[model samples]
Target: MKKKFILLSGLATSLLLSGCWDINEAQRMYYVDGLGIDYKDGQYEIYLQLINFTNVAKSEYPNPQTVPAEVGQAKGKTLEEALFKLFRSIDQKVFWGHMTFIIFSEEALKDKNALSIIDTVLRYRETRYQIWTYCTQDSIKDILLLTPILNKSLISSKLSTPLDTDDQETFVEPVNFRNLVIGLNEPNHEIGIPYVTINKNWETAEQQGQDTTFIGVGVLSKSGFKGLIKNDAARGMQWMHNRTHRGEITFKLDGDETDFLTVTLEKIKVDIEPLVKNNQVTFEVVVKLNATLNGLKTNVSEDEIRKKIIKEVKKEIRTTYKEALAKDIDIYRLSEHLYRKNVKVWKRLEKDGKIPLTPSSISKLEIDVNQVNSGRKTFTGTFND
Candidate 1:
């Protein structure tokens, strides 16, 4: 009787343990790794990036083979309708649990459509909040079709993992779905998202290769896509953000003939102070950077070097601020600073955003750069003869 009761208990436990009875087979599931969305003619265009798992996971296979990624497209009046249209064409069960990144074209991100897409994605039970977010002005089809060089999987490419390159030298910090959602809710603010382009600066053994690169930042508000901040203005905008990371800088000394210094920035911080008086607001910008001297074309003291860095950094900040104001973009987030520090003043000044920010709005711009000790180390030793 005891043995029979024990056997019965074991059977009950086994029945409870059948948790995966409803699990779908991997072979029957189509894993979506990347998503690209574009808008045209009052319709939503959806593009899906699906890579062969065999090529994506090399170590698991004894002799891994390269497989070109497959991209599919569908259009509809609504995002769901378009998605379902694409679903009707595919034979396998599509899965969103493995989505790595999402790309929004400049057109699709307009008029708060980016927020709409995020809302839809979040509603799906299998969707991820950590998926990297980006916007591009390039061709989505061309980008999805370009495979990684040397048989490498898209898993390792900048398209899927951008911070891999940003860590080396950050231009614009990468944004994720969760980050975008939170940023969109900020009052009177637009977020800086990485702006990408297709670059053909690489070559393979047989032919030139193409890859995706973020040249500047794409600013998006609840109002939707503002515009692209390209070139130095984009880079300088980063230097003013709290997310500023390590990067290289080259600046020439003022009033000098080709006397320049190159340094790699380390721990960087940006601070903004809003001074309001008589219902008038002005922002004071201060930037601090710990940097390592990389190259020097002229001889200068450490103090002079620090001063030169400060001058260059301040100039860059002012330049970016000027450009941002022209486009009605608050790259420095000065509006938020005022809203938090002096709400009443912000209200008065915010009445007419037509000219909320002007060149004179920045009463002060300062920079503090500290140098890290580097170069060949000298060791003293004693030798006996």
Candidate 2:
């Protein structure tokens, strides 16, 4: 009985001891916060922002100041090769589960191997599918090296928190790795990635002074980079996609272009209907918005102002549609809507190589603006004093 008991104890001890053999210390692992990819001359450059958890965990109250992250880079012919090279050179093993976002340069998306790079990254077990993706026209190195000045944190809160904002201040809708892949696999295979840029004064000498700005939407067709829609057109793209939540519109109060009144959008609803007749495709877009009078730079009737706002909204939608048509890109995904609603008509059009929407295809657009709040009542001539 004593010998049997001794043998059981020895087996239990071995099992516990074996579990500790592969254990890794938390301090020995590098946690990545963000990743940036750039491609040039058939070479892939990978940039990683490593978070400093020690500083983040420090017990500092109210206005704690500490360096939050550091940047590292490695280059090779493919993403896996570049990542392996990066891991081999670093002293600590890199952990990507904490990675918050990924940015691809315009040049990187233009490469033929861009899809392969995305596949390689997604295949890794360490990377999360929820990481937000972006495309930038600026240098990927500059964007990766940017330090948050106002936020004064290790990671740039502006880049990380944009998707969570309740306001429509952000023009383009953010796409995650999983949705991007799903969109690419769809029948139309149309997707748009938000565009980012750095705004800085070259004359300024401060290191953490520059600000990152989201400028436009980068359109991708059939899993390839197509083009960009910038400025108000970007906002228009959001309107067409039914992604606008809360935004502001500035328009001339009357006939004077210099006099402007800004209205804050409280709510918006968009309806798109696709119709086919005589072998021709046309889309009708109707936009309805509820707004409040936020600014009044000139004295004008509220009724006239509401009319002007509606006209401006319609114009923006038309301009955005024309721009997309000119590039032969469908930012609105009307083709997908047609396929889902009327597959037979879509198939007939597809057989004729007309699955995508064109400029002349969008025949009608309508916009209605309702002023839900006019602010404090205004009296003319001080009550006849």
Candidate 3:
């Protein structure tokens, strides 16, 4: 009887020990890494950047060989139709959950087309809100096909992780999809997303390569896509943007011809006050930043460096406003500033469709540079000399 009970228990354990019979191999699935959307002539085009799961994970592959990403394109009368048409051509099971980036073409922003595309993306159950969004005037296929340098995983590209680059370079701030939606919803507010382009400056012994970089930002208004502002003109954006972490500036002080100073700045602080007087509204902005001398070509005091940096900062902010004013763009969202601080004035000007700020609208500007330090090494001259 004891032997019979032992046999029955062994048989029951075998039933519960069955291995995973329903799991599918990752090698059999096509994982989309990035998406591209474009619209022109009343038609929609979709591009997909597909990655091999083996390349993305270390243990997934036995040999560990890597290949460049694959880009596929399809077109239809609508965004969904284009996506489905692309699906029809794919051979394996498609996975969308790992997608990290989406790019839109300039033509796609016309006639409220951006709205429908954004809505469709959010409606997809597998997609996430953290996806980075960008606009490109370059070829969608080219941007999607650009691979990581040194043959690294495709996930290493700035398209998938922008803040990685910003931590060191800190140009136009990279923003994700959720922040984008909030910018559009807020009344009279303008938001910016990175403008991606293919840079061909890198090459290896056997082959040349392309890298995606931001030359500026694509500004968006509530109505639709506003326009793009170049980086040099938007220099002040690094500070007024409220998201700047660290950046560098190089300049020559007054009365110093042969000497120039390169400073690395961090800990940016900005304050904007909406000043209302006699039914007219203007904004006063004050900015504070800490500096470290990276390169020095001539002798100068810490006090002089601080004052020169302040002057440069003030000039950059005014120049940004001046340039955007030429394009009829309130790049700094001064309209929204007024709306939040002085709603009565904003409503009055908005009712007349006159809230688009002027150059004089930035009534006062102040910049304070502080906490100077000698960087890794000094160049050409000594700070004491």
Number of the top candidate by lDDT? 3
Best by TM-score: 2
Give the per-residue lDDT of model 1 (tens digit) for 253-345.
Answer: 656877776878877888889987766778788888887776554445677667767777777777887888888888777888887887777
Per-residue lDDT over 127-164 for candidate 2, one digit per residue giving the tens place of the 0 to 100 score: 87888888988987787777555534544455665665
Looking at model 3, residue 284 earns an lDDT score of 89
Assess every candidate by TM-score: 0.87, 0.88, 0.87
Looking at model 1, residue 112 earns an lDDT score of 53
Order the numbered candidates by TM-score, best leading: 2, 3, 1
Name the weakest run of 10 consecutive residues (lDDT summed) in model 3.
58-67
Please tell me which model should have the higher lDDT, number 2 or number 3.
3
List lDDT for all candidates, in order.
Answer: 0.78, 0.74, 0.80
User: Which residue ranges in model 3 land beyond 4 Å of their true spot?
Assistant: 1-25, 59-65, 254-258, 351-354, 376-385
Residue 173 shift from truth in candidate 1, angstroms: 1.0
